[model samples]
Target: MGAAGDMSMRCVLLALLTAAAAQPEGPRLISANVGIIQVDCCFNDTVVDHGQVVFNLPSKCLQLVCNYGKIIPRFLGDPGRSHCCEFDGLLYAEGAELAGHCVVMQCTRKGWIPRGDIDDCCKHCSVYDDPHFVTFDGYRYDWHGYCNYSVAQTDRTYNPEAGVFSDFEPCFGGPSCLGRSTFKDHKHTVISLGHSVFNLLVNGDPYAVPLVGAEPVRCSSKVHPVLAWRNGQCTMLLGSSKLMVQHCRHRLDVWAHPTHADNLDGLCGHFNFYDADDFTSRQGDVHPLEYLPSTFPHSWRTLDQTDYRCRQCKSCPPPRVERLCRADERQLAKYTSICEKHLGSVIDRTEGLEGYLETCVFDICMMYQDRRNDREVQDWLGILQKNVNMAHMIINLRLGE
Candidate 1:
């Protein structure tokens, strides 16, 4: 076999080992390909993990589908009103892993929130799509106008209606005003699709440069934190930010479209944040899932929280706030009793829980390839849910009655 094939096998084994060590009870997720899962035989767990009660696994389970259910129509957030037709009885139908590790079998009070419905039953709520700011793309538009990419400047000029974007740009697909250039301040080309990458890979030809790794820089992809783009070279450095969180081994997002990143045949990378920044402005904030945990308002949103795809992406995710939902004095006794019964163990357990929650964030993003598109989203979600359910928690979607 070629050297590349040997290397791929080695990497797969290494990843499996690493995951087993990290999560003892839960299986580690692996994408054999975009639509297909690895389906490792080792991941069938005999123990069930639940939210109200915590349980650890006797052994490691790799990848497996644990739960399967179609979303009830009222549970899913629709532009206008998606009748039961929209609510297919399947989760992880398309893009990703199951829900969280805790709280199995029911929707968590703290679980994902969707918005927009006519009345309570949403028999009459306006469609999820609005004509004004909503674009053909699914990315969200920021109403606060604070979404300008400039780190320092506030009132800078940006043209949203520029021409088409070049292929091979490493971000949300569709057209964007990539704010100002890290190359030059106030220059629009910084946000131009493939401009930064083209400059980095210039043989004076953008397309001529083959994808350097197994992955191509597709839309919905993340960048390294400190990306130095100039003179056709992108020196990616370690940065915690979404635009540059890559591990240097570049690959296409699970959602990388067939054919190319952009070029409207099927409209694959069309819904960039720039594209959808304002689509739901009149309806909801269309918060990126990454920022869903932040205390952003969701008056018009379909759910109070977003989907795994939205939560996992780095699209300049909203600010994360520290939340403290203090236990009322009345209920403190219940929690206190447990804490007192297992004081030292409780401290350790709490710390472990916090650690898992942190890593789970990335798991969420990596789970769904193209999470925003409501079209046939259930299939994508169903697969992910099955994976999650097998190793992690039981997931449920609930609507306010």
Candidate 2:
């Protein structure tokens, strides 16, 4: 129509049409200035300062940032097993102190989170001076008892919800602190089968010594005895490992038939195994089998196994043989069953891959440190985990009987 507004619009539309025709997707034109734009509540740090408000900014800054808002999440890494982080249930690394020692934190969590100690700035893992403690009534437990006990640095108080007994008290004394309540009328028999010796228990006594041609001998009431099973052979204390290993190799697996002891040379051998309570005598002065000096290449002591005197006693007639068939098979199967059950339980209770790795990976690796690389470490870890559990179960089952 040749009107002033119509002429101006025609000129603008003709210029935009020419520019839009050059591109694959045509762009449309809009007014340079528009109505007020909405503000974003959550925004990226790069777009605006975390605390910056769009309304407070100058018009130029607001215009520049008008369409650049984004609600960025706290963490941006892929959520996968490799990205999963974990902390030890009992200890966490805190920043170093001025003294140059790393501080630790005590805390626990059930699942993945962006940060630790969400309720507070500080994060920690519970630490204890003594890892093992007794209950009010006298049951003992270590860090592994997390299933049934709460973490308390020095407090031994029981928690009912956690299944800890209220009356179990902590015991701080030495081995003698174990009273008859733990084991009453204990009897232990050590039958030497020519080169190897087998141990069995009745009540709480474990002093039955086997002979070659005579009846099995029981130690005198005051006589204390320490029995060791090493290299698959059993021996009384004060026997040399070299001689025991030499004689017991051929007869390692054979069960000792009840017979009188003709000579001591036939009885001693390098022991490969032992019960948890094997080292202690009736007098309760000796250490546990795991703590014995032999484990560390130290010299053996007669007094360590005796509370009063260290006199060697004569061997006696063999007692009646009991449970003569498939003893080793029975023992091995028992260990295997206990190990499988406990390992399955561990896997089920663990939350994630990282959680499982944190719980037992170190112990498993350290157990077979002679090996190398990830594959070897993993294989050994699996083998050792099962073996360690089996060994522990054997100890308890044997001693508890």
Candidate 3:
């Protein structure tokens, strides 16, 4: 009984060892002592001893345990359950709709699904050549005032703390060019564009551009403020807002987040996506078309009119002069062709195209006053073309194209 039992037990042990070796490359029985068997788990070429827990599994969502002669797998949580997306410290469940920053997105198991149509998510407004203003609602008008004006002011009702205030200083080149511009957001992030294109200030401190390498310069501790210079243009990003100051031309292009829609006031209009009532004043009174040049712009002037830089026009060109300017078929055709060349595609989707053309004609007339030569007119036209290009770029960027 002793010899036969010993030989048969040795043979059984050999068979068990062979089976363990033949097992797929995972946890397997390494040894046997009396009635006990030693198990080990293999993960990423590392061996885990029996009764030991493996915390660092290939997938962080799972863990492994080496049991007696077997490996047990466990999940950190319910693997089938969908996770929520956290934004601005708020959690949104799957399929939840989120609207903010001028965008509407749906939360999904994988990630966010942005709205296909960008217009439904963002809004744009610009002030360009000779300081022609275009409201967010697409109302176009000319205000030849030289005072510090509020380009936009956030509606306090929607967000008592959030505000965006800007001012334009008169430049000497043309009838009125935006010489210096200042923009301030709710977070106290200030961006100023000086008379010189290279001069940029953030929070009253000069910010160097083309930073070190290919990376953009970012400032501010709480909010995300980015400044980058590319292709002779300077683009600034503050929170969800973006502003592009065109080089040389001093054209100011602003794109506000979708959340700011209907919450903006001042020269930029109500931003409610309606052009009819864009002529609203600072006191929240909507003005008629006849009030644009005088009553409308004067109502939105900054409270402090003490700035020495502020210079009002002595007097506007007489209505007869403006009419003659518009009646010039030769000059009108020239300006119209330039506007069509740069903003042709953009005009199809946006408003204020006709307004831009009229503004061009008026500015050129003001520039010369008497008889203007071809050279002076051509130079002014070049500036207008650059501004139009900047406007086109801003529109494309807002559309996410």
Taking every candidate in turn, the Cα RMSD to the unseen true structure, in Å, is: 27.4, 30.3, 17.1
- Residues forming the 10-long window of minimal summed lDDT in candidate 2: 159-168
Error of 1 at 50 (Å): 76
**Residues 347-386, model 3: lDDT tens digits:** 5565535565566666666555545776877777767766
**lDDT tens readout by residue for model 2, 1-401:** 24764565445444534432332321222434874333333222223332333221111111112222322212112211111212211112122111111111121122111122112111112111112222111122222111011221111122111110001112221111111111011123222223113342322345433432111123433222222222223222211110111012111111111110110110011111222322322223334333112221111121112222222421222222222122254544543454344364654544321222222433332323333455654554454454333333322322111
Best by the TM-score measure: 3
- Cα distance off (Å), candidate 2, residue 150: 28
* Model 1, span 276-364: residue lDDT tens: 33222212244343322232322212111123443343344444443222335554454344323323332333322222222222222
Best by lDDT: 3
1 against 3, candidate with superior lDDT: 3
Query: Which wins on TM-score, candidate 2 or candidate 3?
Result: 3
The local distance difference test score of model 3 is 0.53
Model 1 TM-score relative to the real fold? 0.17
Residue 116 C-alpha lDDT in model 2? 21
